[model samples]
Target: MNLHTWVAARGGIAHREDAREWGYSPSRVRAAIRAGEVQRIRAKWIATSEAPPELRAAAAASGRLTCVSLARRRRWWIPEGASSTVHLQVGGNAHRHSSQAVLHWSDPLVDLGPRSLTTSIEDALAHLARCFRFEEAMMIWESAITRESLDIESLRSVQWRDESSRALARSVRGRSDSGLETVFVVRLRGFGVPIRQQVRLAGHDVDAVIGSHLVIQIDGFAHHSTAADRGRDVAHDAELRMRGYTVLRFTYAQIMHDWDGVERTVSSAVARGLHLPPTERRR
Candidate 1:
């Protein structure tokens, strides 16, 4: 296959510099783009018509599938917006690419070993951790599990000792409180409240959402996550309130220790918002 085909097969170039190494004059690259033989996905790389197909093969073979595409492919993670960049799990031996597909670096030990890269449902969830902030990542995690994208083997396929990996694993366990929330689940349970875990409502979801009371939201501490997610959260809550729902948000810290307090507040707000009498709410 030609260089363009090869790059396309590899899911486009990681960046523009890689294109130069392929020996295409700048003008030629632009001309190819105009002719529709190639396309510039990101500033860095030119994608040949075949790039997407190549990316799929490489992702399966590279053994480290990125969350953005994997999530879409495996139905693992879902987000409100389309991911602009592609995420890949690459090892030391993997050569650099000349495409906009952003490859994530990792040191997998054996082909199927802890250090070896892998392609599976879990990798998609793991990729979300690296690709987005913790809060957003957890949302993907919750969505995957709630949608059943995560599997028992997929969980084991993860290398937990690593911080990012571990955080993701923990997050999965955290949001999936269906009789399995603690180590993470405990905090939610301690409220002496009955939580409807992984429930969908009015086209939005709540992790351990309380019915007939209040809606509780859990947030993680991903860096640079607040400002990015704030407006979206407000809008989401506004819609929920419009639907006759009262929402209460809790962060990781609140869930960790003061969980009871958070629950109490939720319970109170839910009761008050619904205008239910005290005895009626405890049920």
Candidate 2:
């Protein structure tokens, strides 16, 4: 591949070694930079002018994007209120830069080979497991599985150094359709709430069922924007409530932007005994 194509394919930035591996000679690489075809991120990294800002920053920092930084780019669920610092992975023997980025100085479980701008999904998950809290890591991992970005079975076979990472791999399930649902499940779990994801009820697949009667539906913008979709969701929720089940619906905006409000709403329902099964409510 040509230098421009190779750099663009790797998300806009690449290491000199990766560029060389792509059949671009050192002189050609230098010429590209001098001719404004590419911008040098550091002594060893270069980016096309059209490359993404984050990838260029990662290259400038002398690291490949990984952990939460990579996960955010991949649309995986990240922790609420997490820092927006670029997370990068560098080789164990590589010289570290002093950029204001989070760096993981470890050997990746799976090498990127010629792909150096970002870590592979497997390596990102491994780093995520080590760096983030259990709930956050599990949410991201579950989101990855939900999107089929990585196969769960293949991930299962990979060894984990951190106990939390191992737990995350074991806990990931493919039923949750969105990162919102993943966060919701993990958050509810902390409250000792018994919840089942993607529960089939009344001919519709609800996002989650708590206790035995409370149903939760998570709507992302991509799925529930149209008037007909909103109308159908309202009808379904009404039907569920009419069937003696309490229903709670949250939207992408509410979950990601107003999580405190979301938590309060759910917590109030639980406090009012709305989440309990009929038998449990009586007790």
> Candidate 2 has what TM-score?
0.78
Q: Per-residue CA lDDT of candidate 1, range 1-283, in tens?
A: 4446755665464345555666766776777678777667544455665545535434333435567766665554454465656566676645465335667676432345422233555556656677777655665676567667446455756665357767666545535642123323444445454566556867767655554546666675332456757887788889977866667767656655575776577657755644233346454
Model 1 alpha-carbon drift over 4 Å, by segment: 1-64, 109-118, 146-158, 173-194, 198-212, 215-268, 271-283
TM-score of 1: 0.45
Candidate 2 weakest lDDT stretch, 10 residues = 91-100
Report each candidate's C-alpha RMSD, comma-separated, in the order given. Answer: 11.2, 3.8
**86 Cα displacement, candidate 2 (Å):** 1.3
